[model samples]
Structure formats: structure tokens, C-alpha cells
Target: MKAIVKSARGKGAELQRVPVPDCGPQEVLIQVKATSICGTDVHIYEWDEWSQSRVNPPYIFGHEFSGIVVEKGNLVQNVEIGDHVSAETHIVCGHCPQCMTGNAHICQNTEIIGVDRDGCFAEYVVLPSENLWKNDPSLPWDEASVQEPMGNAVHTVLAGDVVGKTVAIIGCGPIGLMAAAVAKAAGASRVFAFDLNDYRLELARKMGATDIINSLNADPLHIVKQETGGAGVDVVCEMSGHPAAMNQGFKMVTNGGRISILSLPVRPVEIDVTNDIVFKGITVQGITGRRMFQTWQQTAGLLQSGQVDVKQMITHHFPLEEFDKGFQLMLEGNCGKVILHP
Candidate 1:
């Protein structure tokens, strides 16, 4: 098996021959057909402070993937061989308080597949049976590889009811674009998307955003207020993770509106809670990962029904041997979610 392996910090990943892994008693062996490069993978490659603290060296890097089950362990009775599948990257302990209460997405004891352990950037990968999800045969492997991130979009938008409400997304990245489509499909009256990059904002427009805001020039708050008749938007999805964008998102929400945050900010920044959140009576919710099987079911249904245009989010594809090129594309911000074939 050939895998792109990160042997040390601040080093380029190399394609090396490695032994294939066998399945555990409760796991299944999947032959990876397609995988996508995520922002976290770029962070790991750059050996940033966050990745230095979170990721140990010599780990296979990738989490968003779709493949076929080649073999199943004896204890894995739900899934079978030859089934098309994707997986929940977060492996949770079912005994935790959050898991017992049916909120496994935020389980206290969680190990992410690529970050904490080996991931799906290789010819074959092993996953716990509980994390594997069966995919509809009508979908292609390239499209299925996006389910993990698409699930993030679904969880963010579905955190609150968006039907007949005006919604705004503060970022036009891959996940943000997905959120735009999901919000429109879920019956949002108007979808506004904001970003610094004009290219991404264009993509957001194609994804069903009724209005696009280039924050570099126009004032997003004023534009959103004017678009909504000064009432502001009913829902604000903050996906930029930038301090300024986060602050603006809080201010863009209407009174009693809901704000769902899906971005992971790197540093602690001060916010004007008095005017932005407290005085406005806004409902703020922090979103992390997916909602376990619930998010998967909703995302799968949307994809199967062709309600969400996920294929538009995939702008580049590369072979496994060209992993470095794919990472460079992401670092340069030249494309959308880049897919890799192993």
C-alpha cells in the first residue's frame, strides 16, 4: 500500500509503501476510493502551532473520504462487504455523559480519525463499525467524499429553524457554500453570503445565496439591514472564524435571532457582548462536528434527493501521488474542496 505519510514536523509528506492494516473486532476495512483535502490538512502540513500541539508525527492525513467496505469484522453486523460508505471522523466513547444523553457529537472523550490516529489518505483504512455510514448507490464516490464537511453545513443550518426566515452566512468557504444551498433548500426566504474573496462569493451565489457581500468594500451590516428592511437577518451562520467577522456576525443578527458558530477561532479575542449579544437578546450556539447519525441521515437524504448541490463545491481533483500539489492549491486558496484519488 502507498500512503502519504508525515514523518516529522514542518516537513513535506512523502508517498511511501506501507503495510495494510487489518480490521479490529468492531471495525471494518475500507478500500478508499476518494478523499478530499481539508483546511486542517493544510494546518498540519504547515506545522502551525495548533497542529503542533494537536497532531502527533508519522500519522496518515485525511478524514473526508468515501469508499467501499472490503471486509467486516465478526462483530460488525450492521454493514457488509461491498457496501459504499463514508465515516464520521470523530470516534466517540459511548459511555461518556454526552454520549449517554444522545449528544455524542460533543462527547468528552473524542478521538478524530486523521488528527488523533491514522486516516483515509491511503489505499486502505480501518474505521469503527459505529462510525461507518452506508451511502446511496446513485451518488458517485467523488460526491460522497464531501459528506463529512457537508454534514457540518447541515448541522450549522439545522441548529435552528430557518424556514421563511432571512439567513446570512459570514463565510463563503466550502462549508459556507454548502450552508447556503442547505438554507435555500430548507425554505429560507432570503440567503445572504459574505466573504473577502470574490471568487468564493461567486460560488456562493451559484449555490443559492440571494445576495453576496464582499466585506472588503461594502458594509455587510448595513447591506444586510437594508436587505431585510432594517430588521437584520433572522439567522446568522458564522463560518469565517476571524475576529472581525465573528463580531460582525453577532451584530448582524436581529433581536431574538439565532446565531450558529461553526468556525474554530485560533486565539481568544474580546467581543462587545453588551451590544452585540446581551442587549440584542440573540441566541448564540457553538457548532462542532456533526450530530452523529442525525446529521448523516439528513445530509444523505438531501444529497439523494438532489436538493443540495454539493458537486459544485468540488473544484479540483488530484491523484494520491500528487498530494503535495493538492495541498498547495488549498494553501494558495485557488480552488474549492480538492479531492484525491488513492
Candidate 2:
């Protein structure tokens, strides 16, 4: 099997011929059709500090994918061979307190597929049956592959109410663009898209962002205030890890509003505890992965119903061997969702 492997430490990955994995009793063998690049994948590709501490080299590293089951173990009853599927990347410890209370998305002992174990970036990959999401046969392969990251957008924007309210999404990356679309479908009266890149801001427009603000050159807080008649937005989805952009999100959100942070900052960011949070009576949440099957159901429903069409945001495609091209585009932040075909 040919896979894009993080062959060594430092930067970049290589296309290598690796031995096909054996399916375990609880696993299924999938023939990958489409896989997408993620920010975490870029971290590993660059051998950044986070990747250095977490991932071991020479491992297949990609998790967002849509594949067809070619073989399955006897114990894997949930899905059979020929099932079109994608997966929930977080393999959780089912016995944890968070899992026991139905918060398994934040389970204490979570092992991420691409980061902690071998993942889908090749012609064939093996994953546990419990993690598979049976995709609707009608969903396009590229669209299906991105449901994992789209699930993140759905989880963040829908963490609280958005209907008939205003929303500010402080990032225009793929997930952030999806956040804009989800906010619109969820009935947000106005969805503000913020980013330093104009290309993504335009993509956000097509994704249903009511207004686009380039925070690099413009004052987002001032613009949002003027747009909302000084009341500020009712919801702020902070998907940019930049400290300044995050603090701007805090300022742009209305009092008694909700702010969900999905981006992982490299270092601790300073927050004005008195003004941006407590005094304003706002709700701040640290959003991680999708909420198990709940967010999955919503993500699938939105995509299936055409309420949150992602066609506009899925901008690039390449063959498995050209994985480097996709990575370069993602690193440059000039593309939307980049999909690779195996």
C-alpha cells in the first residue's frame, strides 16, 4: 500500500510503499477514496513542537477520509463490506467519567486516530468499527471526507442558540467557512466572517457570511459594532488561534452572548477577565471534537438537506502522490478544503 508517511522528524512527509495492515477482530479494512488535509496534519507535517511531543515518526498520518469497506472482522456488526463510510477520529475510553455521563467527546483517555495511531492517507487503512460513520451513498466522496472537520464547525456554532441572532466567526479557514454556513442554516440573522485573508473571506461570502471583515486591515470590533447597531453579535465562534483575533471576538460578542473557542493556540492568551467575560456576563466554552453521535447526526443532516452545502468551500483536489501540493496550499492558507484521492 502507498501512503503519505511522516518518514522522519523535522519538516515534510514522503510517499512510501508500506505493508498493508492486518484487520483486527474489532476493526474494518477500508479502501480510501478521498481524504482531506487538516491543521493538525500540517502541524505533524512541519514537525512542530506539538507534533514532536505527540506523534512518533514513520507512521501513516491522516484521519479525515471517506472510504469503502473492503473487508470487516467478524465482530464488526455495525458495518459490513461495501459500506461507504467516514469516521469519528477521536477513539475514546468508554469507561471514563466524561464518557459515562455522555460527554465522551471530552473523554479523559482519548486517542486521536491520525496523531496517536496509524490513519487514513493511503490506498487502504484500518480503523475500529465503532468509529465508522456510514455515509449516505449519494454524498460525493470529497464531501463525505470533509464531514469530520465540518463536524467541528457544527459543534462550535451550535453549542448554543443562533436562531434569529447575530454571529461572528473569527476565522475563515475551512472549518471557519463551514461555521459561517452552519450559522446561516441554523437561522442566524447575520453572520460576520473575519479573517486576514481576502480569498477566504470571499469563500465565506459564498458560504453565507452576511458580511466579511479583513481583520488585518480593518477594525473588526468597530465594524461589527456598526453593523449590529452597537449591540454586538449574539454569538462568537473563535476559530482563529491568533490572540488578537480571539480577543477581538470577545469584544465583538454582545453581553449575555456565547463564545466558543475551537482553535488551539500555541501559547496561553491573555484575556481581560473583568471586561470581556464576567462584567459582560458572557458564556465562554472551549470546544473540542464533535459531540459523539449527536453532532454527527446534525452534520449529516445539514449536508444531506442542502441547508449547508460545502461545494463552494471544497476548493482543491490532488492524487495521493501529490500530497505535497495539497499541504503547500493549506500552509499558504490560500485554499479552502483540499482533498486527496487514493
Candidate 3:
């Protein structure tokens, strides 16, 4: 099968033919239909500090995808051949404390596909049947492929109630854009989207942001303050990993509001705990991956029901051989969700 392999410890990947993997007794073999480029894939492509320390080279490295079950191992029971599906990226130990108590998304021994094993940037990939998420047969392949990341947006935005309240999304990346849409669909009175790039901010507007503010041009805190009559926003979804923007998120949320953070900053971020958190009496949540199948269920409902349409946000597509083009757009921050057909 043709696959995009990270052949060396460097800044690029190579398209090469590799042997198709065999399905284990508990795993299933999927024929890749469509896959999406993620920020983590960009980190791996750039060989950044996080990728260098986490991923070993010479492996397939993409996790977001939709595929069809072509073959299944003898013990696989959750799905059958010919099922359309996406997957939960995190593979966890079901016996751990987190897993046992229904918090498997944070299992101590979690193994993420693409990071810990060969990923879906190929014609064929194998995964545990337990991780498979059945997709509606009529769902578009590209849209279905993005459920994993959309799950992240759903988990972050819905961490607290947004209904009838003002919410601020502190980034305009793909997930941030989705958060704007989710907040709007969840009945937020106003959705303020912030980002440095106009291209993404425009996309955020398309995704249902009531107001778009380019943080580079206008002060997000000031604009939000004026818009909200000095009360600030009721809910803040912190998707920008930048320390400065994160601090802005802390400052712009109203007293007794909620702040849910999903971005992973490279370095330690400094915050004014006394004034921004304690005195304001806000609820701060550190969001990780989706809340297991619950977030997945909500994400699927939003997409399937047309309540949160994502078609406008998926701005680009490329063939698997042209993986570099997708990565380039992601690096430049000029595109939304980029899907790759295998």
C-alpha cells in the first residue's frame, strides 16, 4: 500500500510503498476513505520539540480518518466488514483507574494512533475494534473523517453551559472555528471569535461567530469588553496555545463564568491567579481529548442533524500523494480542515 512515511528525523515526509499490516485478533483492517490533516501532524512534519520527544521516525503518521471495514479479526465483535467508520484516537487500558471509572480518555497508559503506532495516512490501516466509531452510511467521507477533532471542539465548548450567555473563542483555528459554531448552535447570545489571521477569522465568521476580532489589529479584551458592556463574556473557550492569548482569555471572561482550555502550549504559561481566577470566581477546566464516547455521540448528533453544519469550514482537499500541499496550507494558516483522499 502507498503510505506517507516519516522516513527520517527531519522536516519532511516521503511517499513510499509499504506492506499492509495484518489485523490482530482484536483488531480490524480498514481501507482508508478520507483523512484530515491535524495540528499534531504539522508538529510531526516540522520535527518540533513535542514531536521529537514523542514520536519515533519511520512510521505512518495521521490519525483523523474515515474508512470502511474491509477485513476483521476473528474476535472482533463491535463491528463487521463493510461498515463505514471513524475512530476514537486514544487507545486505553480498560483496567486502569481512569478507564474503570468512566474517564478512559485520560487513561494512564493511553496509546494514541499515529503517535504510538502506524497511522491512517495510508491506503490501509489496522486498529482495535473497540476504537471504531460507526458512521452513517450517507455521511460524506471528508466530513465523517473530521469527527475526532470535532469531538475536541464539542468537548471544549460544551464543558459548561453556553445557552443564553455570551461566549468567546480565543482562537480561529479549525477547532476554534468549530467551537464558534457549537456555541452558536447551543444558543449562546453572542459568539466572539479571536485570532491573528484574517483568513481564519473569516472562516470563524462562516462557522457562526457573531463577531470576529483580529487580535493583531484590535485588542480582543477591549472589543469584548465594549461589546459586553464591561461584563465580559460568560464562557471562554481557550483554544489558542499562545501564552498571551491565553492570558487574554483569562481576562475577558466575566466573574463566575467558565474557561475551558484545550490547547497545549509548548512552554509554561504565567497567569494572574489572584485577580483573573480567584477574585473573579471563575471555573477553569483543563480539557484533554473528548470525553470518551459521550463527546463522540454529541459530535455525531450535531453533524448528522445539520444543527452545526461543518461544510463551510472544510476549505481544502488533496490526494494522499500530495500530503505536503495540505501540510503547507496548515503551516501557513491559510486553510480550514484539509482532507486527504487515499
Q: Cα lDDT of model 2 overall?
A: 0.94
lDDT of 1 by residue, 245-273 (tens): 99889888999999999987777867888
RMSD of 3: 0.8
**Model 3 agreement with the true structure over 185-248: per-residue lDDT tens digits:** 9999999999999999999998999999988899888898899999999999999899999999
Q: For candidate 1, report its TM-score.
A: 0.98
Worst ten in a row by lDDT for model 2: 45-54
- Backbone clash pairs for candidate 3 read none
Query: Cα lDDT of model 1 overall?
Result: 0.91
Off by over 4 Å in 2: none
Q: List the residue pairs that clash in candidate 1.
A: none
**142: Cα error in model 3, Å:** 0.2
Residue 60, model 1: lDDT of: 88
